[model samples]
Target: MVLRAVAVSRTQEDGGRSELLRGTGVGPVGGLAASGLVLGMQCALLGVGAGTGLLALEGARPADALAYGAAVCGTCALLAAATMLLAQLTTDATGARGAGLAALGLLYAGHGVWAAERWSRAGAWSPFALRGAIDPGGADDWCPLLVAGAALLVLLAVAAAAARGRDLGVGLIRFGLRHRRPLRAGGPVTLALRLSRMQLLAWAVATAAVAGVLTAMGENMVELARRGAVEGGVLGSLLGGSDPGAGLLDYIGVLAGALACAQAVVLVGRFAAEERSELVEAERGTGSGSARLLSAWCLVSLLAAALTLGAAALVSGLVGAALLDTTAGDALRLVAGQWPSAAASAGVTALLGGLWPQARWLAWAPLLGRVA
Candidate 1:
């Protein structure tokens, strides 16, 4: 979503019709479609890479890998369509990221809730169940893929309609309440915080939801661990030796840290958007020196990323302590242990963005490779 917004800003810099025509030919919606094409191609390449890696294993077949790659690409395109639709619906870049991620959280949480309750053939109905259809199961079921395609079409249609209703650069609908009075005082740091607050809030809520669900299923996790699922893996050793519950909590903390880094990538993308739109230079012209503005941008984005991760850990720890009979101190401390890694990720992104803004996208490569 952040990328989509940046593409929009880049395609229509300064909201000028000449640029829009020269860059996108038609309008903002066309620019959005072009971005979707690029993203879809990237997703296809990633899927092919993953499938090729799988095929390199001893028992893997080339045909199966190719099929899975195709399926994965289709799934990625559908998901990208949904994200682009959400990006088009928002009035600003930050709002696009916040809304797109929040929607993803809800979709994933809804799938978890549905999976937890419906033990039967619920895969046919869950919108976020693309993993099942693409993985080792290889069941040749195309219903879920068809559903995703339908959803993609719907999202594309709606986004186009919304775009048609709005002006060239503005959104179809605005978010938030308007203040009557215009008297306010804020520096660069404050403005950065304000821009990133919604993104932080959305991530916090998503993390809490995930943690709550994990806590609720503590007994099942314990049973799985006792069944030797948690005793034979490197992850288990890294998490803890024997106590599966604590190990699980730590594992989640590690994942949360990774997610925090992903959020940092989104922040860097936002910085790119601001630069494309000349917002950074305007701020400098308004008396915020270039060095100070850069400092505040990095500091505030890093702070927002760090604080959101901490708050999520704290919330999840409290919930685990309450529902899973775990000590709050242990849970909080274990989760906090992962914060430094996330902080380092944010720092790396900030450094890349500050020193070599043109290559800021490179900062995502390490973290994304780790994830893949």
Candidate 2:
């Protein structure tokens, strides 16, 4: 009787364990699959949109649209696969997060360098100027210099971040050490502040720099606008028919800033995911609460967007004034003009990150749309 009772207990325990595993596995798999489906659909939609736009502009045939769509889809698929592979290879959370941040910084710096070089070599010529400054030799001379300098800057930043991350044994830029002692005086807000302090600071610095750059660039844009070289149409209407090269650079910077904001959103969302996936439970068992955790995560996301975008604007304004002999006041005004759109994009992304933790796949939509 004793042996039979023990055997029955063991059987029941095994059955319960199996049930638990099966139930738990379903949510993760389903979430991942859903995310994948959303991503693929968004990519397809982007391709279709781009193809349609191209057709409308050129009055291309259906076959032309079809070909363009196919190319876009193929490119999206390849990029998606590459991103997933990179994520998989960096299985360690700290490493993965660090890599993502590094990539954002590198992309921003690279695009900036590209813009500067292109403007310098193209000699204030419009893109449609068929007879102007088509010096292959000038491009060859400058392109390599820009690429090398940008690459070096990116590598240095990555290496520095990686070293710091290794020392901390966490993500390079993330805060919040696993606290051991219980809170005696201050409450959840205090905890959140402590946790997100580093991230907020990083965001502030990045945004300030980006804003400065944008402001500087705007001054130069105003000068170009004064010149009648730029045409007066839809494109001109938006960029004030400024130096086409400068306009292109401004657009690129905006796109890069948007991308960086998106990345920040994803990083914050990952924090929520980690919490939901049992990792946070382990930390909570030690003393953290949901309010403290969520606050810290959200704060980081907001700060990142504000700082990086602000920096882009500032830099553009400063550079525009110095390079194009525009007044500082005018550059500031242009930077101010761009704020609403930039803020809207960043705000929407941050809100999405908070509301839909599992829907990070959606962030890729804007990026894919750009590519298309």
Candidate 3:
């Protein structure tokens, strides 16, 4: 939903490409406030909808549902604010959204790892730990929620102050600033790689981190399965259908592959960004064909997907072999299957971007749906 900021940035004259907000008689801070209000309202509506569902499902008191709703609202508003800040730190809206979603993925994965390892007490400071802190089943703790709200406010204040001092449509942190030359024309594929190198590297690191954590988590899950089996609990069968350790490891491996494919989708958005910025037309004017540009981008996304997913699977398999006595074949096969899926995602996004740049954001719909 915060992608709206980027989408709107193109239409508003004072917000377009490089125009200052004050050109519309609104200071940058005021502009932030205005957009922030819109994002907050959206978040609030989402919270109300989500809270209503929670109320229906859990039969919780209205007060508890309202509390959960506030948590959801505040967290979402914070994410939108952070995404706005990211847009100021990236060369384009796509990079900002990609990085923002990646950050959210990392936070969710960290919480997952914490939960999988059963680190209930010591991992209280983990990102999104408020889920447990706000749980009605977990003592109805509210202190952490208040602390998180305070931290979010402070961060928003800092972001607004920083935005006041920055130029429009320029990142505070950028890549290759010292290099002044335009991309060499002979190698469009090379240019694509250069453009997306940083984002790919960031995703690679994040994938590896999650792969390692999930791989390690398999052993803990196996242990819990054994405990549940002894206690005759249903969670044992649910967690580990038959072969506890190996099954959980394979599940984690496939999950890592999915993450890798999602990373590839992030690279696809760079193509969309290029189209939005008219970089595609500029390349065309320099004799680069549209088909070639898009094919090159698709190829880059595929290669990145392969490398990151392959590495993640290898890492997971190696760790599982050592820790959980699992074989590598299943992990390798699972990732092999995802190669085509990643390619498809890349092709879909690249084609949409080439044909209708406005709808390029729709590429994320399927992935978000799956995650949901």
- Expressed as tens digits, the lDDT of each residue in 1-372 for candidate 2 is 111111122222222432353466643233323433554576578678867876785556666565555445433433333232223234233334334444334334434544655654332222111112222212213333233334434433444334323321122344234555554425444544454445555544555554444444444455566675445775476466434435544554555455455545544554555554565676577587765565555555555555555555565656655565544455344443444444444455556656875565575566556544
Candidate 3 structure lDDT: 0.68
Better of 1 and 3 by TM-score: 1
Q: How does each model score on TM-score?
A: 0.85, 0.51, 0.83
What's the C-alpha lDDT at position 93 in model 3? 58
lDDT per residue for candidate 1 within 1-372, as digits (tens), equals 334434444334333532537564566567556666787778779679868987887877776677667677766666566666765567655666667666666666666666666534533344466657655435656666676777778877887777657665556666544743552438887787776776777887776676666555555656566566765556457434466667767766766666777777666556656776778887877798766776676676577666766776776678777665567775676665666666676677778877888887788787777665
Model 2 alpha-carbon drift over 4 Å, by segment? 1-45, 88-224, 241-257, 260-264, 282-288, 326-372
Distance (Å) between predicted and true CA of 47, model 2? 3.0
Clashes of each: 0, 38, 0
Model 1: ten consecutive residues of lowest lDDT: 9-18
Number of the predicted model whose lDDT against the real structure is largest: 3
Tens-digit per-residue lDDT, 127-203, candidate 3: 46765667743366677678877876776687687677667666667777898676563577898888777667766
Best by TM-score: 1
Shift of residue 184 alpha carbon in model 1, Å: 2.6
Tell me the alpha-carbon RMSD of every candidate: 3.4, 13.2, 3.7
Ranking by lDDT: 3, 1, 2
Error of 3 at 256 (Å): 3.0
